[model samples]
Target: MLKPWFALCALFLTLGAIAEPSPRQMALFNNNCVQCHLRPGVGAPLVGKAQDWQTRKAQGEDALLRHVVEGLKGMPPLGYCSACSEADFRALIRFMAGMPAGTGQ
Candidate 1:
């Protein structure tokens, strides 16, 4: 029983580790998202504003990704980060939407 419990704990720990973003991802977010998301009335949802992101989150991750990739409203295509990959977009969206990493999609 103890062996099984330890295995479960290890698995959970590994999963948690994998859920975090890399340093490059952090840089990408700081360089790109912070410019608009941290401000008000920029047409981008302010980071950490649950109410602002709630409606958008309800639209699902796929729809959000599409909007980001194609540009929606005042947001630019690829969210202005041409180097950002799909995973990067997902991580940034989760961060901005106030969802825990790996919880989006």
Candidate 2:
């Protein structure tokens, strides 16, 4: 009985590993952005809200990246990911923007 439960937990963990945000990216997101940005906030969910991101896509990736790097009116600069590299920032922004995980913008 315990063996089955352990196996199920292990499988779930493995599947999560293959999913979005990677460990590093996940840590970065949790630390910096989860506060105001709910998983399904009135604005958008960082995890996977395809339609919300569709509206943002029209603005272009550069605009999206710039918004994060520079900060918009309601958001603070870097959105608190100041330590994040350009590549990291790009990845994070793309992830939150509704693109599939690991899909480099």
Q: Best by lDDT, which number?
A: 1
Pull out the clashing pairs in model 2.
none
| Model 2, position 35: C-alpha lDDT score | 61
Tens digit per residue, CA lDDT, model 2, 1-105: 254335435533644533355568756866787665643454544444456567777897778888888888767788888778777777767656655455544
Best by TM-score: 1
Tell me the RMSD of model 1 versus the true structure: 11.0
All candidates' TM-scores? 0.75, 0.66
- Tens-place lDDT per residue, model 1, 5-66, is 35435533644543455679767876776677766878788766668989998998889889
Off by over 4 Å in 1: 1-19
Error of 1 at 1 (Å): 54
Go through the candidates in order and give each one's C-alpha lDDT: 0.73, 0.63
Model 1 lDDT, residue 90, Cα: 89
Q: Ten-residue segment with the worst summed lDDT in candidate 1?
A: 3-12
